[model samples]
Target: MVRFGVIGTNWITESFIAAGRKVKDFELTAVYSRKLEKAEEFASKHKAVHTFTDIEQMAKSKEIDAAYIASPNALHAEQAKILMQHGVHVLCEKPLASNVAEVKDLIETAKQHDVLLMEAMKSTFLPNFQEVKKHLGKIGTVRRYVAQLCQYSSRYDAYRQGTILNAFNPELSNGATMDIGIYCLYPLAALFGKPKEIKASGTLLESGVDGQATITLTYEEMEAVVYYSKITSSTLPSEIQGEDATIMIDHIGHFEDVKIQYHDSTEKIISGPQDNDHRMFYEIEEFVNLIQSGKRESSINTHELALTVAEIMEKARIQFGLIYPADRLQ
Candidate 1:
């Protein structure tokens, strides 16, 4: 069994632990939070054996073989580095880090410490995504790719009422590009590699964070347009248009249903390896395998992948004037 430590006690963290419960070999050893009450609450609810308010103290101990970080975006790199330094594998949530430099630093720390470090990009670890990669050539000579993930965030309603939650706060390194746009960007880059150039613009909110964003990535043979918004929802499915066929993605982030339309007008649909009730289970399963095998990195959520995603996000933010406090960190 892989003994695990959890950081942050939010909805996403709760969801992750709920999914982890589905894995037979997964064990929630402990949990940490700045507040003792919160830590106790989460630990009790998750059946974690221990709880602590000090992250450093928990990280330095040997109670956990791995830690799942679901903290604020600005804290991800630092938390992962600290845990890895003390001999624990880390599975951090998406966007990996605030910028490329932090992602590189985290990668170096994981390598130096010989500890596993993986970004919780649930989509990449899904069997449906892997299947899509194999059949990508079916849509021969790809010339265009488009991905859009837009959902009206539950927090947005509170934000408009002047609540100003962390989801729209720049200090916490939260924005549409980092929170939602990454779902579109990472999968596209995972399939095609980094683009030659990216031209992006975002609708900056009054708080100086992006409310909506549009990015156009130019490749050698294809031009991809990515659209993401936290203020609205999109009903249109994402697609890859090629010379021979077009591949339709029901949802890039969830990767629920995928379909291919050939030139002959026949359509084929593909689903996952199995019916997984919880989407987060796939990432947890991969994490356990990597830990048991003593692997230092994930093949799917590779160090290179995190760095590329970080670089793209940083550039896009710079283009849109959405700078965060983390960008100034060393």
Candidate 2:
């Protein structure tokens, strides 16, 4: 079994712990937080004996074979670099980095260190998504794709009153694209490589962050549109349109169940169990296997795809004049 250390004390960390319990090949070995008390609390709940307030210490320790970074967006690249350089495999939360340049830098660092590094894009690893691919040919020739991932932010009320939280803060490299749109981008890129051309626009909030955005990808024979929002909600399930059929994904980003409709016929494809524990299990299993087997490359091979999505995000930001300080790097 591969032992993993979890960084961050967020609620997401609890999900990771629960998912680890469900998977047989992996175990949560350590928990880290900036505060000793928070680390202790997480460790106590997860039955972890190792807890650290210092991330660097955890990265260098032998107690953990790898680190699962659940930290904020801006910190992802730097933290992942530290773990990789210290000989710890890293599975970081998605968007990978704030921009493509940072993603390239991290990729190069992983190559230099000969260590495994992958983004925790959980949606792509699930069986439901795999089934989507299996049925892609059944959907007939692809004509258009639309992915909508808009859920009103839990902190939107505070954000509206000028209390800027991380989710609504540009300084943290947070926005609709990084927060929700990447979900749309991932599956699109997975199904259809890079687009031929791209055009995007977003509504910038008062705090200079994107509250909502739409990305239009132009391909040779097809067009794809992605809609992501933190200021509103969407009822439209994400779907693919072809000449003969359409596949509908119930949830925008995560893996669950899918329904495919072709003409007047419909088929249901259910992937994961209806467990509320956490959606992090599948990706965690892949991370452990890669580390144990020394296959540093992700089975999904999404590093290049992450870079493509970052390029699209940068382009969208330019079109909307919604530039974050980190966007300055591009």
Candidate 3:
């Protein structure tokens, strides 16, 4: 079995563990948190063999073959670096680092240590996303792509009551663009390479972070627009338009459903219902396969793709004036 360790005790971490169990060779061997009690509790709940209040201890223990990092955005690179330096593979959550510089650092660290490092972008690994990729030719020449993932944050009510949570905290690198926009941006970058130009506009909250943003990217012969928001919700489905047909994605974040509509008024469903609750299984499976195969990076969520997404986010943040503490450090 490929023994696994998990950092962070949040719902996402739990979800990853649950989904990861479905993989044939997956095992949750360790759990890490800043507090001993929290780590113990989480380890007990997940049935992890070891609990760690210190990440370095876990990294150095040789107890885990790989680690799934779902920590706060700002801590991703630092914690990943620690694990990689000690010869542990890492499956870091999306927006791999707070900025392009950190992504570059993580890439270099993984290279130096000869360890696996892959971004845990679950969407691209899903079957529906692959189907979308496979059927892109049916849509002919792509002309426009519009993706929007605007869900009101559960912590927004608390923020409105004069309480600031990590969801809106700039110090933690939490913002609409980083949190929600990446869902739209990653798929865009994966489908198409870097754009020729970018224009960003967003509404900044009082905490000096974006609440909602619309970014337009200009390519050689096509244009793409993405809308992301944490202060509001949108009912629109993301669509990619082409000369002969268009692909409509029901939920961009989950890639649960997809359909193609042709100019002749013909329609066909390209994707079926997915196990929404266990959507993370695909990425976990990929991570384990890579580790077992002795690969350093994933072809799907590649370092180049993560860097491209990070670079785009950095530019958008610069335009929005949404500066994180890590950005100041660089």
Candidate 4:
């Protein structure tokens, strides 16, 4: 079994631990937190064999073969560099890095050390997303793709009350686009490739962060409009419209089910799985396989998409003036 160590004790870590239980090849060996008390509490709660406050020590420890990084966006690149240098493979959370330079550095560091470095893009690994891609052509010559993911942050209320939370803080590199819109950009890049031209604009809060944004990406024969927000939730289902038919996705990023409808209303296709253990199990499975097989790159989903998504987000950040300190590398 491949032993795993997680770098944070947030919501995503709980999902990773619960999902790791279902994967026979993975073992939850260790967990880390900035505080020793919090680390001990998390270790006991998850039944992790070891816990630590020093990530450097944990990375060099013999207990784990791989590290699952669920830290904030700004910390992802630096933490990944440290882990890779310590000869530990890393499976980092989405957005991978705050900008392209950081992504490049991480990728190069992994390559130089001969260790695996993968972006934990949970949605891409799902069978539902694969099914959606498989039957995308059934939607005819795809002309336009529109996806929206918006959920009002519970922390926003606290931020409004003069409490600064990570979600509203640009220093943490947490915003609607990075938190949610990365979901929209991933599938777009996976399915449509990089756009020929990109235009993005968003409403910025007084805190100098984007609460909601709309991005329009133009390609050869198609264009995609992606909307993301942390200030409000969305009711409209994401859809791809084409000349022949349309495919409606239940959720853009965590698409669990897909329904295909023909233009004539006579042809229809519905496909997906019913198992929903937080839609994070697929990523766990992939990481385990990569660690066990000594693979340096992803065989299921390439890093090309990750690089492209970073590029798009970087451009969007420049356009919207949502600069994180991490963007200094840009």
Q: If ranked by lDDT, best first, what sequence of candidates would result?
A: 3, 1, 4, 2
Residues 218-293, model 4: lDDT tens digits: 9999989999999898877898888888888888877866788776787455655644776778877887887787
Q: Which residue runs does candidate 3 get wrong by more than 4 Å?
A: none
Return the clash pairs for model 2, or none: none
lDDT by residue for model 2 over 234-319, one digit each (tens)? Answer: 87788899898888887867656687787878665645564434667778777777777878788684578777777887777878
Which residue pairs overlap in candidate 1's backbone?
A: none
Alpha-carbon TM-score of each model against the true structure = 0.97, 0.94, 0.99, 0.97
TM-score leader: 3
Give the residue spans of candidate 1 off by over 4 A.
Answer: none
Give the true-structure RMSD of model 1.
Answer: 1.1
Q: Can you give the lDDT of residue 3 in candidate 4?
A: 88
Candidate achieving the largest lDDT: 3
- For candidate 4, what's the RMSD? 1.3
Error of 2 at 147 (Å): 0.8
Candidate 3 per-residue lDDT, tens place, 157-232, comes to 9999999999999888988999989999999999998999999999999998899999999998799999989999
Q: lDDT per residue, candidate 1, 200-234, as tens digits?
A: 99999998799999999999999999999999998
RMSD of each: 1.1, 1.8, 0.8, 1.3
